[model samples]
Target chain A: MKAIVHVGLKPGVLDPQGKAVADTLGRLGFDEVGSARIGKVIELDLTGDLDAAAAEARVREMCETLLANTVIESYRIELQA
Target chain B: MKAIVHVGLKPGVLDPQGKAVADTLGRLGFDEVGSARIGKVIELDLTGDLDAAAAEARVREMCETLLANTVIESYRIELQA
Candidate 1:
């Protein structure tokens, strides 16, 4: 199975990277562009016999414990075969 | 409309960040983790009357031109409303 994790600054939080992308887009004549927010995606190729729910729980724990800063960020997880 | 862009190192590319995450997970006892690849996801709450297909085309162009390094990275785009 494969798991994809996405982490990003929470709504209402300041995102310098996203701002930079937006700024660059504006300068490049993409006048229609209003905002851009950047986040991280981690694709994991799992092994062994970990079941789906267990894998999700473990992955969520990983996110809350290490992969993301919950204070100022939010994360989403997706699983695929 | 909203646009979500997922950018990641190509299959053959080296990802130091992903490796770091994997190392940390291993140390934390996620022995089931075999490999981790890190990437980026950008979510934009777009404005204007940009049609879905047109927005996607523009986004693809943006990815090709600046948002991603095609030589070493791959990108996927999604549209949500």
Candidate 2:
């Protein structure tokens, strides 16, 4: 089985990296660009011993404990077998 | 409009970051974890001037030229209104 965790900053948080990227895009002539917010994608491959529910639960726990800083970021989980 | 670009390492490419993360997870007691690949998610907000197709093309170009290292990475683009 495989799981993908997509992590993003909360809406109100300031993202300097995104701001830099947006500014660079404008300098590069993409004038229509308004803003950019950078995040992370964590892909995990696991043994098939666990069922879908268990896999999702474990992955979610991983996100909560290690993959994300819940105070300023949010994450979504997608599981594939 | 909004666009999300997900950049990931190509298959067979070495990912030291992923290896480190997987090892950390194992140390933290998530022993069932097999492999972990870390990637980036870039979210762009643009003016509604461009149509969906055009927006996608522009974002794809951005990924190819700036956001991702196409030599060893692959990117996927998603456009949302």
Q: How many residue pairs clash in each candidate?
A: 0, 0
Residue B18 local lDDT, model 2: 95
Q: Which portions of model 2 miss their true places by more than 4 Å?
A: none
DockQ of each: 0.80, 0.82
TM-score each candidate.
0.93, 0.95
Model 1 ranges with Cα > 4 A deviation: none
- What shift in Å separates residue B17 of candidate 2 from its native position after superposition? 0.8
What number of backbone clashes does candidate 2 have, counting pairs of residues 3 or more apart or in separate chains? 0
A1-81 per-residue lDDT for model 2 (tens digits): 999999999999999999999999989988878999999999998875999899999999999989999999999999988
What does candidate 2's lDDT look like per residue over B3-81, in tens digits?
Answer: 9888999999999999998999999999889999999999899985899999999998788778999999999999899
Cα lDDT, all candidates: 0.88, 0.92
Best by the lDDT measure: 2
What range of 10 consecutive residues in model 2 chain B has the weakest lDDT sum? B57-66
* Superposition TM-score, candidate 2 onto the true structure: 0.95
